[model samples]
Target: MKLHFLGTCAGTEPMLDRKHASVAVECDKKLYWFDAGEGCSYTGHNMGLDLLDVKNIIISHTHMDHIGGLGNLLWNIRKLTQMRSELPHFDGVDVFIPNEDSKDGLLKLLSHTEENFCCDYENRFYGVQDGVLLDDGKVKVTAYHNTHLVRWETDKPLSYSYRIEAEGKSVVYSGDVGLYTDLDPVIGDGCDALLIETGHFGIDIAYDYIKDKNVKRVFFTHNGREIINDREGSLAKVARLFEGRGTICEDTLTVEL
Candidate 1:
């Protein structure tokens, strides 16, 4: 499996060498996109990835940094369909989102685009709930809710983490988690790779959490200022502390496992 890191910045102001939070998992010759952060489509296409091969669009939550470029992504997909002689492999895409208002708002936004967002393929959006989300032939994804935003007990959750299993390998994506323990349910005993977000936490916190856990590789995404301000020091620290198991991922870099 391959993981393409399109954007690695958090929900902070503009920064150099970073965009936002987004990544794509390539498995079974298909692409599964997670988060449509700003400029994701631009970066992905430039990286030589066929956007048409994307079969699933999974959003952790509706935060701006996470969904800012969603409309543009759809528009690009439609635009590319006209340029290419053939259509997307899936003929359409399934979008798994958590907030109904956000989904509705995006659809409404798309309607204002050219041709009223018309296309030859179908695009479906579904609300995300805690459970086995998708089990395509090559991958199984499970969602675990987290308390990122304060809400009433009756309100549906607004945040989640994901566990993706493919070809006997497991990956835990920490989607702007409220706390590290928020991923316990999805992570279980261990995961082959932990794509943990550090937008709301630090590397030390991650180190403490995974030091004893069975995480083979750790890639830090949605990074905070500490790492950005001291990348050289952070790299050395991670090398020594994680024993070369941790990496500060960068946008446009694809890692295969």
Candidate 2:
């Protein structure tokens, strides 16, 4: 399996060579989208990822920076059907999102786009909750609630982190946690890799949080100013501290797990 980073920028203003927070896990030729930040499908397509093979799209939250390209992603997948004769083996794409309002709004917005957002393949939406969400034979995705969002009217969570187990390896996505410790339960004892988002925090805090943990690998993503503004310095610091156990992920980069 491999991990492809489509966008690595945070919610901040546009920066050089970065878009937003989006990542895709490729397993057995199928794609599992983690987030659909701005231009995610565009970047994935350009990176040689076949959007038709996208079996699932999971969103951490409904924030614009996190879901800005969700509609386009769906639209592009449908558009590709006209250019190709093949359909996914599943013949559909399942989306897991935490916010029902965002899903409704996206569908409404897509209705105004070309072809009235019609597609031969089914695009199903599932509400995210804290539990094992899906086991597709290729991968098992589990969701855990985080303190990224709170609601006074309901007990539903508006943000989540995902624990993905595939090929006997486990990976945890932080998904913009409110605190580093927020991932403790989801991470459990350890994981093969931690795709920790740095959009809301810095590398120092990230390092400090995981320094003594059993995490085998670390990939710093959703870059913030501290790392993006000083790539060389940050890379050097990570290399020195983590000693090859850490990496600073950039857009369009793919890594094997």
> How many residue pairs clash in all the candidates, one count each?
0, 0
**Stretches of candidate 2 above 4 Å error?**
86-90
Estimate, for each residue in 29-146, the C-alpha lDDT of model 2 and write its tens digit: 9999999999999999998999988999999988888899999999999888867766544488999989887788889999999878877779899999999989978799999999
Residue pair clashes in candidate 1: none
lDDT of 2: 0.91
Weakest ten-residue segment in model 2 by summed lDDT: 82-91
Q: After superposition, how far is residue 140 of candidate 2 from its true place, in Å?
A: 0.4
Q: For model 1, what is the C-alpha lDDT against the true structure?
A: 0.88
Cα RMSD of predicted structure 2 = 1.3
